[model samples]
Target: MKRSKLKWYGAKSELIELTKALIENGNLKGKQEDIFNEIQEVFNIELNNIDQAITKFNTRNQENETKFLDTLKNTLSKYIKSKLEKNR
Candidate 1:
């Protein structure tokens, strides 16, 4: 089955290019399980950053800003998860 392209701004594009570069530069030379585990760690780090950002924005319009950021984080994380699952 064909996978659908994610629409989380440049995140998915950057991720794909980085994965390509890793493979091309032989940085990703490892067993499939090892690679999958590494990718999961990357996603977890990114998600934590998003969580931090959401907490960092505490200005007047905090609720609005947080909602927007939460949306972005959800979409981005979802995209990353989909890409990993698709590859598997």
Candidate 2:
């Protein structure tokens, strides 16, 4: 697949978190490392030391740990609400 010009500016830990969620929810199928490798390939970014990154992410305060995912949830909720309102 062609690599996108878009780059992931968020922390690698955020990607790791998303990857884990996808796998756990059965949205994605594969070992975490393999899925992460595909993500890196698609984004054309290298994420080294994933184990260390995950460790650091887990050690963060509760509110901070899933910051990116929380933001994603909020953003998607707003978008859906806006669409629903537009159709009402």
Candidate 3:
């Protein structure tokens, strides 16, 4: 059977929370480009470059992460968690 794209309830909110947490923890410093690359690499999403990645993320209003995309999200989330822990 074919699988459908994952439908999340509060993906956008979660993204916001994740962003805020990363910022508050200063985990967002010096890794902007690497973060964008991680998103593309983990999601198999092709973005032109770091700026495009930032633009895409900034332009999104409210969006849900599909199954494959969720994999990317989780990967990033783990990265943030690790960073937060490491810095503490």
Candidate 4:
């Protein structure tokens, strides 16, 4: 899909605030529809900027996911090894 060009002035700032809100809230507490509506309300004017922000957010999210999984795997491996040694 073709991305709309971002509106520079207030749009970028609004998008930044929206991004921060999402990150801080993480699992936004509300009905899915309401949450979506809120997002739409915020980004409706600056749809293009929203697209750009989403792309960046997705990239960061993937990186964070990889780091989290790696940490979890290492922790589990150590825990399993300790248990096995104790059982032996």
Best candidate according to lDDT: 2
Superposed by TM-score, candidate 1 places the C-alpha of residue 18 at a distance from the truth, in angstroms, of 0.5
For 1-88, candidate 1 gives per-residue lDDT tens digits of 3433433344533443444446558889886345644554655423224323323444427565444446657999999999999999
The alpha-carbon lDDT assigned to residue 21 of candidate 1 equals 46
Which tens-of-lDDT digit does each residue in 1-88 have in candidate 4?
4444543344453445454455457857665446644555554542445445545655766556334335657889999999999999
**How well does each candidate superpose onto the true structure, as a TM-score?**
0.30, 0.76, 0.28, 0.31
Native-to-model Cα distance after best TM-score fit, residue 65 in candidate 4, in Å: 6.0
The full ranking of all candidates by TM-score, starting with the best, is: 2, 4, 1, 3
Query: Which predicted model would earn the best TM-score?
Result: 2
Each model's lDDT: 0.51, 0.83, 0.53, 0.54
After superposing candidate 3, which stretches have Cα over 4 Å from the reference? 1-30, 49-88
User: Which pairs clash inside model 3?
Assistant: none
lDDT of 2 by residue, 1-88 (tens): 5658878888777787787778779999978889888888877788888788777767889888877789999999999999999999
Give candidate 2's whole-model lDDT: 0.83
For candidate 1, the lDDT comes to: 0.51
Error of 2 at 57 (Å): 2.4
State the lDDT at 79 in candidate 2.
Answer: 100
Cα displacement (angstroms), candidate 3, residue 32, comes to: 0.5
